[model samples]
Every structure is written in C-alpha cells, then in structure tokens.
Target: MKKAVLASALSWALLAGCSQPAQTDQTIHQVNSVTNSSSVSDQTTLTAAQYSEQFIAELWQLYPEYALYVGYYDYDDQLPIANPQRRAQELAWLQQQQATISQLLETDLTDHQRTDLSLMANFVKRGIWQIESFKSWQWDPSEYNVAGGFAQIVNGNYKPEIERLRTILKRLEHVPAYYQAAQANVSKPAIPQTRLAIQQNQGVASVLGDELLAKAIASDMTEAEKIQFEQRLSDAQLAVATYIDFLTELLPEVEGADPVYRLGDTVYEQKFAFDIQSQLTAKQLYERALADQKMIHGKMAELTTELWSTYFADQAMPAEPMAAIGQMLERLSQVHAKPAEFKAAVEQQIPELIAFIKANDLMTLDDDKPLVIRHTPEYMRGYAVASIQAPGPYDAKANTYYNVMPLDGMPAEQAESFLREYNQYLMQVLNIHEAIPGHYTQLVYANKSPSLIKSIIRNGAMIEGWAVFAERMMLEAGYGDFEPELWLMYYKWNLRVVTNTILDYSIQVLGMEQEQAMDLMVNQAFQQQAEAAGKWRRATLSQVQLTSYYAGFSDILVLRDKAKQAWGEDYSIKRFNETFLSYGNAPVPVIAELMLK
Candidate 1:
C-alpha cells in the first residue's frame, strides 16, 4: 500500500495536467511536432546543445514556480499570470515555442538531436495546454495549492523568503477575485448522493482561514509590508465570504439533492486517464491492482515462513505474524535519533554514500550544488513523512533537504514505538531514496539538463521510480552489510505499494467505504489504527496517488531491461543512469521512446 501510494502520488501529479488542454488542431500539431522531433534525434553536437539550452531558458519563463523549484530564480518575485487575458498571452508564447521547435526539427539534425527536440517540444505543448485549458486556477479547491502555500510560509523550521512571502500576500489579495472567477466558470453537473460538501467546505475554510490567512497576517513584516499584507488579507477574506455566499445561493440550483457533485462516468474516466497516463481502462487497472495485491500477499506469506524458520528457530511462534514483526520493529526502533542524532547519522552516511558512488564511478556529482539533510518542521509534517525540497531556479546552490520528523512531543512509550518503526535500516532506506543515487543524484543531473520542458513536466513516477530502483540497486550491490533486515526493509516498502493499489481500487472502483479501507490497511498492511484511518482519508482526498510507486517501479524496470537489451555488453549501470537522468523526469512512455530510439 505504501508502495502504491508513492507510485500513485507521483503519477497522479503528472496526469493532473494531462486533460487540461482543450484539444485544438494547433495544440495537437504543437504536441505532435515536439514528440516527433524527439523520436528521431541521435546527434550530440555543439549546435544541438545550444538549441536545447536556448529552448530550456525560454520554457523556464512559462512556469516560474517550477523554474524556482528546479533552482532557476531569474523571475523569483513574479507569479504566473492567472487572469484570462494573461493566460491567452502565455498560450501565445507556447505556440511560438512550439513553432520554433518544429522549425528546428526541420533542420539537418541528428537522430539524437531530433529526439531531444521532440522531448522539449512535447514539454512546451503540454505546458501550454495545462496553462491555457486545464483551468487549475478554477480548481482552487485542490490540496496541492493549499499545501504549496503552507510550504512557502512556514515549512515550520525554515524561514520564509521575503519574495515568497510577498507572493503569498499577492495571492491572498487575489483570492476573492480567484474565487469569484471560479464561481463564474465552475459547472455543477451532477451531485452525488453521498457527497461530503460540508466536510470539503470546512476543510477548504480551515486551510484558508487558519493556515493561510492567519499565518500570513502573523508574519513579522516591515510596517509598509504589514499594511500591504493586511489589505490583501481583507480582499481575500471578502472573496472567500463571497464564495460561501455563492455556494449558498447555488445550493438550490443543483440538479440533485445529494451533497456530492457527481462528475459522471465520462468525466471520471477522463480524469482517471489524464492522471494515470496509460491507455489502460479503469476496469483494466482495477483488475491489475487486484491481481498484484494477491501476488504480494503470497510473497509476504512465503517470507513469513522463511524468516520464522531461519531467525526464530529457538523461540515459539507468535500467535500472529504481526507480533513477530512488532518485536523486530521494537529492536530496530532502539536506534532512534533526536535532531542532533539525526544530523549525525546523515553526516556519517552521506560521505560513505558519496564515496561508494565515486568508487563505483557512478554519475558525476555537481560540485556547484551540494546536498544537505535536515529534520522536518512541525508544520510540514502533515503533508509528507519526508521530501527532497528542490532548489530554486535562480539559485545556483542546489541542496536536497532530507526531512526527518522529530519525536519531541510524544509520550515516552509512544516515542519508543515510533522510534522502533524508524530504526537504522529504515533510515538507510530513506537515505538511499532521498539522497545518494536517488532524488538528490537524479535531480542534480536533471537540474543541469538542456531541456527546460522536461523539467517543467517533471513526473513524480520517474522521481519515486528512480528512488525505489536505487534501493534495489543498492541491495544488489550488497548494501546494508548484506543483512536480511535490509531485505525486510525492502519488503516493508512494498507495504505502501500493496496498500496504495488496494485502497485506490477499493474506494474508486469497488465502492468500498472509508471504514472498510481503513480496516484493510490495518489488517493487511500492519498500519496502526490511527495511521490506517489517516491513510483512508488520504485515499479519498487523493485518488490513484498510491499506485505510482508500483507503476513507476514497474515502468523503470522495463526501461532498464530495454536499455540493457539495446546496449548489451556496452551497457554500464552508471552510464544508463546518467543518460536517463539527462532527460530529466519525463513520462515513462516518452522516456522509453527517447531511449529506445
């Protein structure tokens, strides 16, 4: 389930932008041209490099936040134009890029160069579509927007930048305008009999009122800044109030008596495909998930028997497998670290991982951007257990922060249990995923890539896929002192995969209630009751996010095999990794097309 969630989260984000662009001939041409050009490119000459670099620079300006997140900060203080007029202008810019890239494709370029061009062009077309058609601004109700706003303000431990703070203020000022626009544009076609409009409304308000508004006003700004911020706050409040009023007025206009807005099967299918990026029908995906779930269950059963016979030969078997697992977890938890301890662990492991990479002659690390690991703050805890906060676009120094949440406020017994769950082996798993040969390593190369478009459409599947792949790689390379516990950790990671697949299908397809999903999580995945409940809530809030890990890992494995088959004896692990990372994190199909060519 954990694996599935990780996979789904990554894929969900990618697919979110899939159906955004209204299909127009021009748009289709733009998308096709880029994809076709890349399908043929083969050369790596100076001219190709120049063209790629130039195109990336132009592309970066289209999505400022993405640019900033990727360490490009030329227009740090500026926000993407959200108004209809501005969107039209941005769309025009995309059209120009597409035309230019298409022209470039007509040049006498090598297959590799053409491939790179197609990749970049596809990126431009996608970006244009998302910006112009998706109306992400209209769907301001997404948790991502709220979470992004929170991350900017108080990632809790880190200080918010003045520019970021200013952007937040601006966004707040425009909230009322945003909501009004959404109200005007939003169409409520069908209402679900079991819709939780009230809960969603409350959730939206809490995020806006308590998290966004309160946090913004509480910031210690300069006198002038404060006044400006307050004005924006007033405007946002007014907008939200108006939105509530609009909702009330439209309540009677709804076609159905149910609180839930029924998106209908067609719309739901569109959303599902857009997010998953696969041609697989919903029924197909659901069946695949069920089959995968059963297979994982069998693997767990086999492992249980093997571990019990090998490791616990002297002791009597526990009544439940979870009891034995719990004992092992307890032993592992003894290796807990406070902030200082956590830092020390990082200090010890990072250099070793670096040395291993260098010794193994893996891809070269960028001396310019060093990776750093740190503890997560309280505020950001709710969103992620840990993450790699990518560097801003303008910032040359790229640091990947490995956030280890502190166990400061818990009761002694609870703290012990938590620590047991996060022992050394678990930490190593995280380190490999977030740091060396994982996100940090992959992203460093991605940051330096020539294609700006790939960076913008950065798929989470690729990101998590690489991390999960890296774990397996390390194991194959004899990591974790060749201990069974390390292998156990790998299996535990699959817990996410299993849980994600089951819950996604159960909730979205099988129509399993949240309570039932929670029960499955606790029983099958060994998640604590509270954690299981939270997982159920998250599943409802985020559909298909859990499937990304398994799906991504599966795709990556296929990619690896294809690369090996194509290169044969010429293939080197390091070279393949570098080549893969060079494209940045693109969709698997796109990446496969580029690599195979």
Candidate 2:
C-alpha cells in the first residue's frame, strides 16, 4: 500500500491544531489565560486569526502528543489520560470552540481567514463527534499507544539531544497513568485493534530501551537528573509491557461479541464526511469509482492490445480483454527490484524524479528540505509497505522519511509476490505518489501555508488526491519518454487508486468477503496476490482512508479542468499547482471554489 504520512499519535492525528510551549509555567499560564478570558461572546471582539491562535493553544493542552508531532513541544512532558473526565473536558472545549468559531464566521473576514475559520469549525465538530458519537477511544485499544508520541520526541531534532532527553524524562512521568486510564476506558475491544495495540507496544523498547539510557548517560544531565530519568524510563517500559499483557489477555474474551474491524454504513459515511471533507459524499465517490474502473479497464485493454505484438509476438492475443491484459501484466511484472534491492531502487529514483519535475517546470521544487529513505519504523509496521513521515508544519527542516518496509524474513513465495506487485514501472508511479512531488513535497508546501488552521485541519482527500494527481501529471509530462510499457503499467497503478475506493466502500459498508475482494483486486484491478492481500488487511484495519485516493484524485482532476477554462489564456499548470497548493492542504472543493472564482 502506498500509504503516506504518519501524523504523530493516530487518535487526533488528522485534527491538526496547536501545541503548548516547552516551559511549564508559560504553557500553563498561556493556556489558562486564554480559557479564563475567552468565551463565545468575547470571540467576536477578536479577529479570526487571533482567535485561531488562542483555540490552538487550548487544543494543544488537550492533545499534547499531537502538538509534539506537529513540532510544538510545550506539552512534551504531558500525555492525555483517556478517562471520562478527560473526555468530558475535550467535549466541553470542543463545544466552546465550535460556538466561538460559528460566531467568528458570521463576522466580516478575509477570504483566507474565512477558509481557516471554516476548517477550524469543522475540526471542532469532528472532535466532538469523535467523542460523543464515534467514540473510537472506547473500543479501539490501538488508539491508545504512547510509543509513537515518544518516538517523535526522541527521534525528532527540533531541539538539542540533551534538551530533548530532558523533555522525554518529563514525559515519562505520565506513561503509567496514561496506560492505566487506557485500560479503564476500553470496553468490548475489537480483536484486530487489540492485536495491533500489542504489536505496536512491543516497539516501546525502541524508545525507552537501553539506547535512550545510553544517550542520557552520555549527555550533560546532572547525576540526580540521570538517575531520575533512568527510573522513569524503567517504569514507562513496565507500563507499556503491562498494557500489552492486558490486551493479550483481553483478546480471547472479546471474541464472544463477534468483534468486527469494519464500521457499518452509518459510521463509515459520517467518518468519510469528517475525514475526507470532500464535496462529494462517500456513495457519490464510490459510484464515480465504479464508472472510473470501467473506463480504466477499457484503456488498459487498448494498451494491452497495442503492446501484445511487442511482448507476445510468438503467441496469439486472447479474445478477452481481461485475459490479454493479465498476461501482459504478468510479463511486465517480471521486471522488478530484488527483495534485498527494493529500498535501493526507491532511493535511486529520487534524483530521477527531481530531474523530471524541474526539466518540465511542473512546479517550484524546494531543494532545502531533505528526503530520507529509511526502514519503516517497527511501531508503524503491519499497515502499509511504504509510507512517508514528513515533518509537521512547525518543524519543516526535519527530514521527511520515505519509510520502505524491508522484505527480509518474508517467505520466498510471498516476497516474490510482493515484488511483482510493486514491479518496476508501478514502483516509479508509487514514488511519484509517495515521495518527490507527492506527499513529501505537498506537505512541505502545506507547512509553508500562512494559515495554521488549514495546515493543522488537513483534509485527507486533498492530501491523498494531490499525490494521486501527481502520478498522472508526471506521466503526462513525459517522465518515461512516452513508453507504451510505462503507460500500460501506469494504467494498472491508476486501477489501484480506483479500486481502493471500491474495496474500502465494499468491505466497510457492503460486507465484502475475502474471496470476492481478492477477485476484485487481483483479477479486475490487476493487483498481484501479495498486494491484494495486504490491501485487504489494510481495508479491514482502516475505514474511509482507502477511499481518499480516488476521492481526492477525482476532485483534483475536475478542479484542474475548471481552472483551465476559468483562467483561459492565463492558465498554466505551474500557476494552477502552486495556487492550489498555496491554500495549504485544504480540501480540493474549497481550493476549487477559490481558484475558479
């Protein structure tokens, strides 16, 4: 799966907002000052921009980990405890923020400020819905892990090593209480989430283990501070271990509820609304995907026929479109990186992609931001084979990691299947979608956005859509010198995007079984066995996320066409791209409304 971007902790990762200062006195005082003085009626006195800043600070107090991930360190030492008291606090805060935003939206404001305010309003509403209605915190144990947040601090370079270590030492104080609250809050846990929680927690050693201790020992901390740090780290490790044990024990007991990973139609639809924030509804997106799938299949068949003589001159072309296409794909799939060489292959393509973008003058490429291709973190594994971990909007200078899962230890047959799925041509498309002018590039632009509201309250459809759009844009610009083979493979890659919408909607809402889903992906979508299986696992583990690719891609394509006609002779791809991206990672429909105006 070409999943991109890990936004710190997953609980409120999508709801980007605020972070506290590193100093406790200042952080508390600033937050308290805002809360004590600010009210909905008072919000009308402040400009939207000023109110937004205040609201973000209050949100940071609620979700310190999210702030830390986004490069705000004020709440570095704090971790939220998932109990009724905290939930109630979150609900109250969101309600107040929602009312304040609604009042602000009624007053006069700049278009930019208005957009930001609207995004903040939506984010507040989503948070309220998540607590009062969606309530994943009550059922999803995987939502409770602290490892990713800690890893963000330890692995991050926003501060000096010693300073970060001190922050970590302070944060460790909350670990035991956080887990205890997690244990109390979860009820009727989904089996998949329980297993994922255990699996992810096993990675706590990566952060709190001897390596961190070694760093502290080598640092400039005083002896007393070092001892205190050591004790806290040990306790934090025990807390994580205990949480894992609790989950392991609870797994079999929850089987009686016939626990499911799939959220039904009603829940899935609402999540799509909040998570995607697209102009089209989930059902509308699914219908478009079905139509798109047929169109892509027709094109693939035409390409297959065109290429048959080149690869299979010795044999007759099959009368059936699918059979011909499948055979051609099998032939092309033979060209792939060896399991050991996969990461190296991706690394090598970075420069090639950069050259292509610049040569074509697709858009301005930032040379300052570094892209690092590395092994997928242990804590983040089992979901996607490759993903991008870009620095949050606050920390743009941090490395944007292109996390590629190593193929080591996979059974030979499985590894071969996997490689075939990500074959040579499709791999290039994946890079375009996940790196270069895809997620990494888009996120960098997102951070540069003047509006923090837009940056933090990011729309998944806009983010994923741009990456999907990047795939086709790069190809159309003649990246592969118009190779029919490359174009044929590109069609297959596009099929993955289209089918992702179909697969997600089908499984989550329509109850698609494994056999039917495999047939849809492997046979109809032309995915390899390994890729299809991994996607099926991903579909079950997630809701609404799979649909983002198609949702965003379709929205972007439509918007670009509109921009062409609206701008007329003024239109240029570079202008459209930069202008569209300038709005930060706001939803495509919002950007379209602005640009087409």
Candidate 3:
C-alpha cells in the first residue's frame, strides 16, 4: 500500500524514441515560427531530439512529483492534486503538446521518430486528459491513505527522514479535507466489490492508528507539532474506522446490487488499449491463455511422470487430481515445522540466490542495496497472496519485501496443509520473482536509468514480465540443480499464470459463476481445495492484474526471439537483457519501439 504518483520526466524517457531525420532549413524554420521561435537557437532547424528534450522539460515542470518517482530529486516535496483546475491545466498542456508533436511529425524525421511521436501523442491523450476527466476523489483518501501511510512506516523504520515524514504527516492531516472535497465534487458511486476497499479500510486503521500514531507520539518533536500529529492521527483513525463500519453496515443492504462497478465493455477496451497498446480484444486474449494452458498441461503431465518415476519408484503416481495435489501439499508442509524455521531458511537462501545471479551475469548486483523479506502487515494482508514493496522516494536504498500470510482462523491440520503448499521450492520460485534477477534487479536498473520520464509510467507488464521470464531463466540456469521437485514447482508457478488468465476472462468476460471458477482452478491448475477457495475470492476482487505476469512474459519472449533473429551471432544474453530493461518499465510495444530501433 505504498502510494506513489507516476514520475513525469521518467515516463517521457521511456516514451521518447529516436527523433526524425534532419529537416530542411525551410521546414525547420517554418515549424519553429509556428511553435516557439526561441527554440530556434544557433541551429537553423529543430531536430526531433531537440524537440523531445524541450517537450519533456515542459512536462517535468507541469508534473514534478513524477520526476521525483523517476529518481529526479528536484521535486521531492511536491504533490499534484487531481482537482478541477489541475485537470483543466493538464488537458490544456496535453493539447498544446499534441499540436507541437503533430507539427514536428509533418516535417522530415526518421521512422523511429515517427513511431515515438505516435506513442507520445497517445500517451498524452490517454494518460493526461483521460485521467484528468475521470478523476475520482475516492482515489485520494482511501488509496492515498493506505498507500502513503504504510510507505512512511516501512521506510521510516529502515531509515528515518524526519522532514519527509513530517510532510507525509501534514498530508495525512488533510485527509478529511480531501475526502470531503471528493464527496463534494464527485459522485460517491457504490463501492466496487472488486476493489479492496474493505481490506484497505482495515489496513489504514492498523497502520495509521497503531504504527504511525505510536511513532509520532514517541518522537521528540516540539509540543505543538506533537499535539498536531496526535490529533491528526486520531482524526485519520476515526475516518478509517467509520468508513469500515459504514461498508460493513451497508454490505447486506447492497448485497443484491451488482458486485462489480464496471466501466463496461467500451471503457474496459479503452483501458486495455492504453495499457498494452494492442488491438487484441478480451476474447482474443482469453483464447490465447486457454491455448497456452492446454499446451503447458501436456508438458507438465510428461514431466510429472518422469518426476514420480525418479523419486517414488515403488509407488504409482497419484491419478486423482485431489490426491496428487494433496500429496504435494503434504510434502511442502513437512519442510517447515515453525515460522521461525521457515524464515531462517528463507534468509539463508536469499544471499545464495543473489550470488547465483551475479556469477551468471544475468543482471547487475546492487550489493550496496540488499533486499529484505518479511511477513505482510496485519491490515494489508487480506488483499494479497504475496507482494513486493519498493524503496521510498527519499531513500535511494532498495529493500524488497516478500509478504507471506500464515494461516489463521483454521484448524491445525488445515493450517499445516496451507503452509506446506507454499513450501521450499515454492518459496524459491517466489524469491526469483520478488528478488534476485527479477523485480529487485530490474527495479534497481530502472531507478538508475538516465531517462526519468521512463521510470514514472512504470508498466506492470514489463516488471511482471521480467519476473515471470526470470522464473523460466532460473530453471534453465540449473536452479535447484535440475531437481524434478523444483521443476514441479516451476509448473505450479505456470499454473498460477494460466489460472489467472482463465479467471480474468471467465468471470469478467464470459460471466462464469464463482463455483464453476473454483472447480476449474482445482481440476485444471491442481490447486488445493483451500487454496482454490481463497483464489476464487481473490479473483473476484482483482481481475486482469494477475494476467499481467504471463501477458508480459509472452511479449518478452517474442521480443527475445526477434532480437536473436536480428542479432544472430552478435547476440549476447547479458547484452540483450540489459538492453531490454534499459527502456524502463514500458509496455511491450513501447519497449519494442524503443529498443528494437
């Protein structure tokens, strides 16, 4: 629940491509006169590079917070509100920039520049104007509170920055005002069940009330500041508590209402297009996912036979899906007797994983910035099966958190069974994705990229794609020393990808029932009964997000194969990976246009 605004400058870098070829003196002069005469310095004509630079600089001034997130330290304290005035101003700016880019496109530029302009124009339209008009206050208080509050606490403990914390506290103090403003300006549409509002409300109360308030009161601040912090904390706590109460009380009343507050088909299509820059419909993507599942299942069946023959030579492989899944779950549980033992094993394995990546040169190791894994906080734990929280804005140091929930409110046998399902090999697969050459590595490089613009528009497709790709890479790299159990773990990870895609389409597009989805999870993915039940709930709450990993990995593979074909003997794995990640976390299409050039 770390609230971070998209970085403006970094996003531009990722979006910018090579400019068009040199324009004739006449064309340059004509464009300069229509745009900005001042831009026509000693040079008679404006190059695409020069125009891109000027355009980005203007955008940075408009959205400085974006710059901060992208590693630009110049605008550390700025917060851009999505208010009416700001929205109007942003729209005006986008229109102006669009015109400017359009004028440049009319001139003679390289093919790369034309593609870059197309992306930039689309980016401005979708991101700036669309988001502005669609602004909802719900985003400010609820999402902002939980994301901002937890970020402060987590980072504050690791490295205390009193000034920044105070700024965040001031923001928290105004939460009521923001919420009130949102109520006044926007319609308080029925809360979407798909959103984690209930869980978020609970999280805000836990972190802001217990953790943040406790820290603020304990700090040696001026008496006035201490009192202000205490009062603000109290107000935040009440706001969150009341919201939770309201939601619970209204739940039964609204039970007959649509569970999902959808934007419907058209809006969903727009969002999909903006996110991936693809024309593929939801139906098309669903078919692809199903096809992939079928192919992978066939491969997994063969591999499972080999593994059972190797490990349990005397015993026949479990034929029933439930029995097979149960056996694996039992084996997983036997590995960790207690939480302490589990943590210790994780701690020992992380460094070894890091070392493996370094020795293989899969990615550059930031030894100066190590990753830290911990359990999910009590409040936010409900929404996520697992998550990774990046380092804060003020802190350059990188810390990666792995949040695993311990089974509670269940029978002892049930709890043990649940924990076993997430045993050693599962942990390793998670580690590869959350740490090592996955998120940690890619994020570090992204943070350090020269283009601040690329960092702000952080694409989930790239980040998740790299992690999913890394899981395959690790197995191929002889991770677990080619052990068949580990290979089974890899297939389990694949199952997650396949199930996510299926659930997204089934529930969101095909209108599949909850019970049917659960059945599919158990039968097709071999998910444990308890796990399948929980996943059904999660699928209802979060749609399409889970598909990002596999969707991204598919794109990455396409790009990788294209690179191999193009580079031939010149291709090097390290160079290809480095180049692929250099574009920041842009979508696959943007990455292709940026790097393939």
Candidate 4:
C-alpha cells in the first residue's frame, strides 16, 4: 500500500483523536493557581479517526499475524496469543475502547468520522463478545492453531527475503509458546474441529519444517544464517507435532462431537447478528432460505426440462420436469474437466470472465492489480473447493491468490467424482464468484477506502454476497453469449448458495441430521454425491458462514434493484457496482444507507 499516504492521514487523525494529556497536572497547587473553577479540565480526547487508528494499531499488537498479512511489518515477529491471560487483556481493552467510543461527541465529528466511530466501536464490541459472549475459542481448536505462521511470511513478496526470514525466524522461535498457550486454553474441544485441526497441523508442521524451509533456503541468506533458520524450523515443527499429539490424545475425552454441531437457538441468533450483521433473526433467515430453496428448485426444473429436450431428445425420460431435473443435472455434470485439468480449467475461465465484465461495463477493472491462480496450500485444504485470498488493506498492492484445489494423485474414483461435481459450467460461475468481479474486485476497492476501519472489519456477508451477486450479474449480462448451459449451470450453482443457508441453519440450530442435510444438498440442490459430502463436512466445521452467500446475495440484489428503481434513467449497472463497492465491504444496510442518501 502507499504507506506514506495511509500513515500521514492515519497519524494526523489518530494523534489528534488519541493523544493523552501532555502532563497530568501533577503539582497543580504548588505554583499555578486556576483563575476559574473549571480551568483544570484539559484532558485530551481522541477524535474518532484517531480512535479508529488506535484500535487498528492495538489490534495489530494483539493479532500480529493479521498485521503481517496486511503489510504492517512492525509486529511481524509475533502471532496471536490465545491463552486466558491474553483473552482477558483483550476483553478489558475492548471494554475500555467501547466505553471511550460511546462517550465521543457526534457533533464534533465529520461524516466519515461518525461512520468510523460506528465501525470501530462495533469492532471493539465484537472483539469483546467473541472473547466473553460466544466463546468459540473455548471449543474450536482450529481457532487456536498458529500453524500457518511461516507460510504467511513466505507466501508473497511483501518484503525483502532476508527481512521476511528474520520475521519468520522470530515467529518460529515462539512456536513452543504459541502451542503451549493453545494447549492451555482449549479446555473443551469440538470433535470434528479438533480432528481437522490435528490433521491440518500435521500438514502445517511439515510445511513449516520442510516445504517452508526449502523455499526460504532458495531466498538470499547466508549459510550460517541458514543453519540458524533450520534449527528454529525444527523446533517449530516439534511444537506443532506436539500440539497435534495433544489434540489426538484429547479427542476421545472431549465432548460435543455428536454429529449435531448446532449452537442452539439463542447463541445462533447472536452469532448471526455478528457474522451476518443483518436485522433479520435466525428464524426469519431460515424461513427465507427455505422459501428460496423452493424457488430455486422451481427455476432449475424449467432449465432442466429445456436441457433434456435439447441434449436427450430421443432418450426415454420422465414426463414431469421435476422428476427429470436430476437426470438433466447428471448430464451437465458429465461435461466436467478431467481430474488433472481442474486447475487449468479454472485458470482458463479468468480471461473470459474479465472480458465479459469489461464488455458489459459492469465496473472499473484494475488491470495492474496482481492475481495468481495457484494450488491451495496444504494447511488450508479439505475445507472448500477454492478461495480468493485477497491482500489485506495494508498489503493492497500485493497479489490476490486464487487457491484452487488440485486433484493430482487422488484415487481415480474420488478425483472423477470431484471433477464431475464441479464440471465446466459451474466452474465458470465459481471463477466469476472468486475472481473477476467477486471478491477480487470488491476487496480492491475496500483497500482504497479512506477509512482503514472499513477494510479492517469487513462484513463477511458483504464480501461473499458480492461474489454471489457477481455470478448473477454476469449471467444476466448474457455471458457465454447467452448460453442456456451457462444459465442452467448458474441456476444450479445459485441453488448451492440458497441451500447453503438452509443447510447451515438446519445443522447448526435445527439440529438437522447429517443424512437429511446430505439429502437436501444432493436431492433438492442437485449437487453431486462428492459435492454433497464435502458440504456436509464443511457445515459440520462451520456455522453462519455458509449462510453468508445466500443472505448477502439476496440483500445485495434487493439494494441494487432498489437503486435501479430510485435512479430510473440515471441508473447504471456500472454505477451501482462501483458505488456499492466504494463503501469497502461495510454491512449491506450501512452501504444501503450510504447509496440511498
């Protein structure tokens, strides 16, 4: 990022807002006498901008890994400390910050400052709630895993090789402390989350000791320095391996592994408030998701019938389109990329998606921004098909990694099933959602926002929603020259988003059975068996996250249509896209207010 600019603005605003009284009037009565009764009230109060900057600085101190990822090098040697003491300190700090923010005078602030106050105050409160209220850090072992420390340092070219390795070695030296804290803090473990943590830690440890070290060795460093690095890496590997062992031993004794991963009704709602940042309650969202599921199914039925007549004209097919929808979906799945070609197929779709976005004038595209499609890191696989790891606001100029899972060397049947599930049509939709105008475009604008607070505390729903929205936007713009196959695939993929909300809410709150959830994915959503199975595991691993796609997409569509109606002839898709993204992934409602007014 252009740090000189961010620093100058941040330093000026924050210094004004957060500066302490120059001297605390220690000996006021000794020499100087106040002429008026209220003359001694000169304590410095931070402006909203300063408060926001202070919050970011303090947050980086607490979670240094984030600072590093966002291109802040000051605290790169440290990672998050998740022990009880750190949690308590974080909780107390948030409590103080929250109180300080509440007491600020709105009349003294600018429009941006007021919004900054709201965003940062909420950020502090959410931090407090996560530590004190919901307390997933208590059971979620994955939350405590500091396994990606080295990979983070080596993943990009944010700094010089020697400097990056210095930080890596500093962090590596603290590995024992990091895991020891995790071991001490995670008193209760969720079975699935724990198992996955252990499994991934093994991979993470290997990467840190072997893959990461090998990569770092290729960097510019002295032989003596290399030996020092190798020793530190070994120690770090031991730390992670020990953590995995601890989890493995604790797996049997830990409770809450019952296939049901729901956070009950009350907790789920509170999480929804934080995670979704929406006015709708869990019950209301569930009802909407159910309605959407049915609606999307109806749409799929129409598309499937059309596909069947075109692709299977002579075959003996069921008369009812609903009955034949499954068959048509299967036919579509048959056109998938081969196991080895899945990654290549995704890469090939990028230029096409970019072209479509440009042709439609959907939004301004930054051709100079860095984006690379690479294999998903070992430490983060088995969670999802693909992800867009956008550079943090601080690292705005760095690459946005599109991590796609590769199917190399997998068992033939598993690879084939995975390929069949993604297929070509859905891959196109997925590419649009992850690259082109989805997260990549939205996040770029976020980094450019004047207030760093917005990008720092981005709404998950907004980010996911834009990607989901992008998929629909592309389809509506006649992508693939208005191909029915594109529409059919888009509709089916849309079903995945809709069903995602239902599946997550059902499993997490309704205690929906694994079998029932799988049925919903495979039968209702038209997902392949492999795809359905992966989703079930993901739903087990997460709550409220899956809901973001549907919740966010639906809300964004509503806002866009509302804008269209309000603006009429002045309305343009390009304007809506640019304007909506300019708010830097704030909550949809917040953005709605900004756009509307």
Best by lDDT: 2
Tell how far residue 197 is off in model 3, in angstroms.
1.7
Clashing pairs in 2: 20-74, 21-74
TM-score, every prediction: 0.69, 0.94, 0.80, 0.89
- Give the per-residue lDDT of model 3 (tens digit) for 463-560: 77788888898788777898877787678778777778778667766677767887788777766666776777665554455566767888888888
- C-alpha local distance difference test of each model: 0.55, 0.80, 0.58, 0.70
Q: Model 1 over residues 234-288: C-alpha lDDT tens digits? A: 6665665665555555455654323222233454455544544544655565577
lDDT of 2 at 579: 90
**Cα lDDT for residue 555, candidate 1:** 75
Candidate 1 lDDT for residue 302: 53
Worst 10 residues of 2 by lDDT: 17-26
Q: The CA-based lDDT of model 2 is what?
A: 0.80
- 168-258: candidate 2 lDDT, tens digit per residue: 8887887888788778877888787677777777876876799889999999999999999999989998998998998898878534433
Candidate 1: stretches off by over 4 Å: 1-62, 80-140, 143-303, 309-314, 318-349, 359-363, 374-381, 392-396, 406-420
**Candidate 2, which segments miss by more than 4 Å at Cα?**
1-4, 7-11, 16-41, 253-259
Model 3, position 512: C-alpha lDDT score? 75
Candidate 4 vs. true structure, TM-score: 0.89
The sequence of per-residue lDDT tens digits that candidate 4 reaches over residues 1-597 is: 000001001111111111000110111221122211222122137666666666676656555555555567676666544555455554555666677777774448876677767776666666666666666666766655454445667765777877888778766776777777777767678888777777667667545757678866887788877888899888877888888888889777545435545698888887788667776887898899888877877887777766776888899778776568878878778888878788888888888888878877888999889988888776766677787776677778888888887788888888878887788888887888888788778878888877687776767788888889988888888887778777877888888888888888888777888889888888788787888988888788777878878778888989999999999999999999998998886878788877888
Ranking of models by TM-score: 2, 4, 3, 1
Question: In candidate 4, which residue pairs get closer than 3 Å at backbone N, Cα or C atoms, i.e. clash?
Answer: 14-50, 17-46, 17-47, 262-508
